[model samples]
Target: MSNDDGSMKELVEFVAKALVDEVDRIEISEITGNQTNIIELKVAKEDIGKVIGRQGRTADAIRTILNCAAAKLNRRYILQIIDE
Candidate 1:
């Protein structure tokens, strides 16, 4: 993985872990492409709403941050939240 992918994974993992009760249950993985990196965040089922937040405001905020950070690296990132 490139530095951007690694950083994106860490960023999402950090944010999600902080919002959830089951920190140990948080899983973050990245799929990197030529132009985009997909960051998948899996969290405990009960914490999905917390990560997503009311009306998805939290999720949007995360995406926005990812976009800005990816821009600094001249890459693109997509964040996907998975419940387990």
Candidate 2:
């Protein structure tokens, strides 16, 4: 992973940890591609709702932040919240 990828992973992890009750259960994985990067986030079953928020607004906000950061690097980022 490139430094940008690592920073993106850290950004997701940091946000997820702040939103969830089970911080230790949070797991973040990144799949880097030529033009796009996928960041997969896993949290405890009970904390899924917190990360996603009502009507997915919180999740959307996170993605917006990620996209803004990715824009500076000329990349696209997708954040996938995995409940399992």
lDDT, each prediction: 0.88, 0.91
Q: What value of lDDT does candidate 1 attain over all alpha carbons?
A: 0.88
Model 2: lDDT of residue 46: 99
Q: Identify the runs in model 2 with alpha carbons over 4 angstroms from their true place.
A: none
lDDT of predicted model 2: 0.91
- Which runs in model 1 stand beyond 4 Å of their true positions? none
Q: Model 2: clashing residue pairs? A: none
- Superposed on all Cα atoms, the candidates' RMSDs to the truth, in angstroms, are 1.0, 0.8
Candidate 2 TM-score, C-alpha based: 0.96
lDDT per residue for candidate 1 within 1-84, as digits (tens), equals 656468778888878877899999998888878887788889999999999999999999999989998898889888999999
**lDDT at 10, model 1:** 83
Which digits, one per residue and each the tens of the lDDT, describe model 2 over residues 1-84? Answer: 678768988998989988998999999998888888899999999999999999999999999999998888889999999987
